[model samples]
Target: MSINARLFYVYRIVSRMYFHLSVLFVYFFTLDLPVWKIELLLGVYAIVLLLTSKLNAAMLTRMPHKQVIALGELIKAGGLAALIANEHLGILLVGQILSGLGYSLAQGTDSSLLRTIMPDMQAYKKAESGSSSYTFASFLLSGIIGSIIFNYSHEYAFWCSIGANAIAITAVLLIREPAHTNTQQEARGAKPTETSAQKFWKLYYSITRAFAMATFVGFLPYYFFTQTQVSLNIFGLILSLFTLLGFISARFIVRAGNVYGFAKIAATSALLCTASMALLGSSSYLPFGIVALAVLGLASGGVRPLTLSNLNMGEWTPTQRTALLSSMEQSFGLWNAILLIAGGFAIDSIGFQWLMLILAVVYVVLMTVGYWLYHIHTAQPTAAAEQIQ
Candidate 1:
């Protein structure tokens, strides 16, 4: 099979149900475990994710991404098995930590693998692929399936998730290791002038992309927690709005990707997220908050995959794909974790509106940096148009 085909199978299984069980398990066992404990776990989970992302990315660069990812999947399955047996809070935490690590390893690496398998630049060449629409559909599907499994048996969902990881593991084993080839750099036919300003711009864009994702996903828990006290049904409705917008937007991510280009799409998404947060923060009305959330959810769906794809296509040493990926993973995971923890506290103390406003400002600054990344990159090539194309 083509590498893409093999990896697609891997994606189908691992992506499909891994999230399903992670969330289902959390709701069933961990949701009511008290806010403080949950916050502590989130903190730990962030640290664990950073460690794993760093290790996996390093391994993939030095050796092979496929092997690293496969090992992660195997470990995940084993962890799940342990969770099934122990059924203790400690056990569940351990299981989640392991699984989170596994997820961190796979998330960005999987998309990079897909890029390796594509038919060059014409065939959706990026660190990631697909669209916002794709994410929405996948998320909606996972939630629907996961909910059904939970309704019947949460334990069954856990087992089923493990089974899915097994399938991913099996597929990972069969796939060829994607080699690092810095064609995008070479294609530019010129090296970036090592100037402070140029370096700053590159860093700026990456930070912005990361910040956008952090704000969207991180602050969400705060929003949800705030609503929990008022009415559970209202909270559920808001979540449903996020899911609905996310799924509907997924239908358009591919088109947006093609039309605006990935980086532009990501920037637009950042702006959308910022606007959503700002709007939500401004409104006391439940309907206003819900509307803002849905729009923000759609943009969040777009930005995460899009910007990560840009990072994947950067000019890292081909021999150091793993290390580069690891760095990316660490940046994303650590910040994401920090954001969640901080946002949780912000919700408990100040309230969601203020948290959103604060985050929205941050998002604007980050996205502005992202907007300039393209210009800075364009400075790299003598034959800029020919190469970037």
Candidate 2:
């Protein structure tokens, strides 16, 4: 792999540092806003992330990738500093909105750039394994480090995230574009490839479907808030534990996908989700609640990467696909804002367990949607092949 490609891998390692820094964001996130208000902000923030994903995709296809990403990073850094000073709910919301752009740029372009460095599809997959695993491990490590930082000093913990992001920004700037990019561009017209427009729609479908899957996955927070009703400290610990477990479980999920293929793995995951939801709906005992929620963690961890990693399967370069994923993530924030608040309200108005019943039904419906879309996606190819015959 080229130096730039190595940087892409190394950048993943450095991202652990960014996670460490985010430990303190919860402080600023809730500073002036009520918990309900905070949830609302998060909802809006998610929508912006989706929009950012769209813009980043456009820029990558139409402009210089490196420069565009750098500009977004610069804006992010500035936005963070502004939040530190402004600290108003409105100001904080704006900062988060712009930060979505930063996320989109980094995710989309980084993977795309690495593809340029490693053009052979098989070779690229093999190479991605190392970075992907390290990044996964880093999540647990960051949570540990974040906990330690929070225990000692919340302010310092947040600063750690800032420093890590700063390093990421610098590292991104140093990466040199691959020589292959120009060669590929010159050879582009040799045979017409898929148009960017078709690629974009494919990207949209893959991501939105993934996002739909996530609607069920995000039950962690609701479960914590409603079922346990623990203090923020305990809530954080549980959430971290969930992520840590999810991180550990993700490796096995990857293998399962490789062995059985992503479609089957996804189907199996949906099955787990349906079962878990049913358990949550009917189980009155706290232990049953815990078990049901853990099942959710297992299902979510297993499926998230399966869907996210392969999202580019349609035709876009890794970068464009990643950007599409980022857009999907942004949509996630939006969906979260609406769904979470609704869940909270429903909990207050109706019984908490009843809300689970509704979500359970939603889960089953989403799985059906997943199955339908998979067939739809597969049918197109099969139909095309039949026509070719």
Q: Write one digit per residue (lDDT tens) for candidate 1, span 239-345.
A: 54566675555456645766766545655666777788788788767668667877866775544444443443544433244445455566656766776677766
Please give each candidate's TM-score. 0.74, 0.75
- lDDT score for candidate 2 against the true structure: 0.55
Please state the error at residue 295 of candidate 2 in Å.
3.4
Count of clashes, each model: 7, 7
List candidate 1 segments past 4 Å from native.
Answer: 1-16, 19-31, 61-63, 79-89, 124-128, 131-136, 176-244, 247-264, 308-319, 369-389
TM-score: model 2 vs. ground truth: 0.75
lDDT leader:
1
